[model samples]
Target: MTTNHLELSGRILRSRRFDSPAGIHHTVLQLEHKSLKTEANMQRQVYCVIQVILSGERFERLTDKLKAGVDIQVSGFIALQQSRNGQSRLVLHAENVELKN
Candidate 1:
C-alpha cells in the first residue's frame, strides 16, 4: 500500500476545535517548525509552517490542553486541503500527538 506519512515536531502556533456536519469532533492546529540544515557544507536555518488536524476521540481529549506555543510531536498522513478557491495546500491529518517538554 502506498503511504503518505509525515511526522513533525514543533511548537503550536494556533489550535481550535470545531464539529463537522457528521457530528465528528475535529481540532485544527498550526505548527511552526524550525531547524538547522546543512547544505553544501553550510548550516542554514530552515523554517516551515503547516496545518494539522486531530479528529475524533483524540480531539475531545486534547482540545483543552492544546494551545499556542506548546511543543509537541505529531505523526500522521499528508493530504490535500480541500478548498473552494482552487488554492489547496498540503495538510497533515494527525493520528497521534506526543506532548513535549
Candidate 2:
C-alpha cells in the first residue's frame, strides 16, 4: 500500500467553523508556513499557505484554541477538494493539531 501523510508547522491565518447537514462539526483553518531548507547543497527559503480541515465532535473542543495568528502543528493526509465551481484545491485533513509555544 502506498502511504500519504504530511506534518507541517505554521501560524493560523484564518479559522472558521461550520456544521454539515449530517450534524458533524467541522473547522477549517488557513495555515501559513515559512522555513529554510538545504536543497542540492544550497539553502532555500520556502513559504506557503494551505487549508486544513478538522472534522468531528472531538475537534469542537479545540475551536477556541484555533485562531488567527496562533502558531500550531498539524499532521494528516492531503486530499483534493472540488468546489461547486469545478475548481480543485489541495486541503489537509488534520488528524491531530497541537499548539506551539
Error of 1 at 79 (Å): 0.6
Winner by lDDT: 2
Clashing pairs in 2: none
* 10 residues in a row with least lDDT, candidate 1: 57-66
Residue-level lDDT for 4 in candidate 2 = 91
Best by TM-score: 2
Model 2 C-alpha lDDT per residue in residues 1-101, reported as the tens digit of each score? 99999999999999999999999999999999999999999999999999999999988778899999999999999999999999999999999999998
lDDT of 1 at 2: 92
**Residue 34, candidate 1: how far off, in angstroms?**
0.5
For residues 1-101, what per-residue lDDT tens digits would candidate 1 score against the true structure? 89788998999999988899999999999999999999999999999999999989755867788899999999999988868988989999998898899
Model 1's alpha-carbon lDDT is 0.91
